[model samples]
Target chain A: DAGVTQSPTHLIKTRGQQVTLRCSPKSGHDTVSWYQQALGQGPQFIFQYYEEEERQRGNFPDRFSGHQFPNYSSELNVNALLLGDSALYLCASSLRTGDLMGTEAFFGQGTRLTVV
Target chain B: DQQVKQNSPSLSVQEGRISILNCDYTNSMFDYFLWYKKYPAEGPTFLISISSIKDKNEDGRFTVFLNKSAKHLSLHIVPSQPGDSAVYFCAASVAGKSTFGDGTTLTVKP
Candidate 1:
């Protein structure tokens, strides 16, 4: 079975430009989350989407936004990208249980974004 | 403030030995802890997890131990193999919002 899938394995964007990364969650999954992994560091949570609406967010700024489609796919948009925005954009999917008990997250290969 | 911290940036263990990676957190609200393994040019894969109510959970050769009072968790791999070498990340969550630590790279030598 195809796990979480992301598009445009690698991308290059200039400063101040905007970019959108896409993700299709694994079959039977309802929640999608985005994360940024900088060089030599672990991933930083960007935000999470559930039922076509943003359910939770991390410490990211307004420039970072996301949308969850009815099919449970997701898009992560970063506006006015800076050089620091260059990192690996990871997409993870999971089954959301009401208790927020933290179920296992299945991740995609990730889209590497390079901001010049 | 960085809530989750992996003090050891890297570790090297001989094959067939036990490899233990440690993590600490400062947030009291974090009740769930997970360990993820990442290879180069790939997203992290969930290795194991432990809830606050449980101090230990084992899956085959992999085990996760949680210490709520200490706000710490650890992942142990027995009989480490070369293929087990990778970057390991420790993550803590509260209400499904997770905070990841700077990963620890493990190298298993044959």
Candidate 2:
């Protein structure tokens, strides 16, 4: 009955430092997507993964990359972090490989990242 | 530019009244619209959704209305309860890519 889970509830890093955040999707889910929510703004889609392959992605730079594991878990890697990178990193899971129309996505509590 | 826009940053209403939240999107490709309720320090939780094929969908006290012509959509909460007070975010999707609005904070006063 456990939902999506994320590691390091909160993280703080300095500029130029790299960070990797992890996520374990809810049981019976096969797809995982990452989103970045900046202060006072809605979440911006980062990318989505299905079957261990990156199926779809948003407008984020190559510096923002992700990986999906055989177990359906995911990790978002942001390199050369900037102060702008500071935001709430959210991981959502869906049952289907398609978009929101095909399945409902359940999101995790999110990892709050702060760049000093 | 913000493809999806929720103009109201915050709104307040009396308990047991109706709370209407509005959202507008610039992308015509967006066919699926959803409303997510989020609390402070937490990720948004899916509240309800309406597909382009359907103009309106209702469940219990929550309803979502879509107007393709207006490129707009709205979420109506009837008999609003105190628990309904939260930041409501509107999201639109096409394929696997989705866009969300800034959000509107709703406060239902008792």
Candidate 3:
């Protein structure tokens, strides 16, 4: 089965500009989550999308937003990007079982965003 | 605050030796813990995990031990191989969110 996939393996953006990263969840998965991995740091949770609505979020600014399409694909948008926004953006997909999150998640290679 | 912390930034071991990576968490509510390994330019791949209800979980040569009382967990790789050299991440999950550690870079020398 095809695993989770992300677009634009690498990107470069300018400050005060906007950028959108895309993600296609693994087949048979329903939930999509985004994470940011800064240099020499672990992946930090950004937010999660389920049922086409944002279900959970982490300690991120309002400028970070995302959308989940009906096909289970997702897009993460960052407005007014800052140099600190430069990091590896990863997309993870899992299947929701009842009220609990999937026990294991499959991740994509991630998109490396560099803000200049 | 970092809910999950892997204090050791890097570890090195001789081939065929045991490799233990430690992780500590500050959140008591976290019940599920997992370990992931990542190569350069690649996303982390899930390795093994343990639930709060159990203290140990093993798969083949990989094992994970959880100590709920201490809010600590560890991943053990027996007879490590050179190919195992990579960054290992520890994560704790509650609800639908997961918090990850800074990762430990492991180098297995042949």
Query: Could you report the DockQ of all the candidates, in the order they appear?
Result: 0.83, 0.73, 0.80
Q: Compute the interface RMSD for each candidate structure.
A: 0.9, 1.3, 1.0
lDDT of 3 by residue, A38-99 (tens): 99999999999999999999999999999999999999999999999999999999999996
Task: Flag clash pairs in model 1.
Answer: none
* Candidate 2 per-residue lDDT over residues B40-102, each given as its tens digit: 877789899888899999989999999999999999999999999999999998886679999
Q: Is the docking of candidate 1 incorrect, acceptable, medium or high quality?
A: high
Error of 1 at B83 (Å): 1.0
Please list the residue runs of candidate 1 whose C-alpha ends up more than 4 Å from where it truly belongs after superposition. Answer: none
Q: After superposition, how far is residue B94 of candidate 1 from its true place, in Å?
A: 0.9
Ranking by TM-score: 3, 1, 2
Candidate ranking (DockQ, best to worst): 1, 3, 2
- Going through the candidates in order, the fraction of native interface contacts each one reproduces equals 0.76, 0.63, 0.75
Error of 3 at A60 (Å): 0.4
Give every collision pair in model 3.
Answer: none
TM-score of each: 0.98, 0.97, 0.98
- Single out the weakest 10-residue window by summed lDDT for candidate 2 chain A: A96-105
User: Which residue ranges in model 3 land beyond 4 Å of their true spot?
Assistant: none
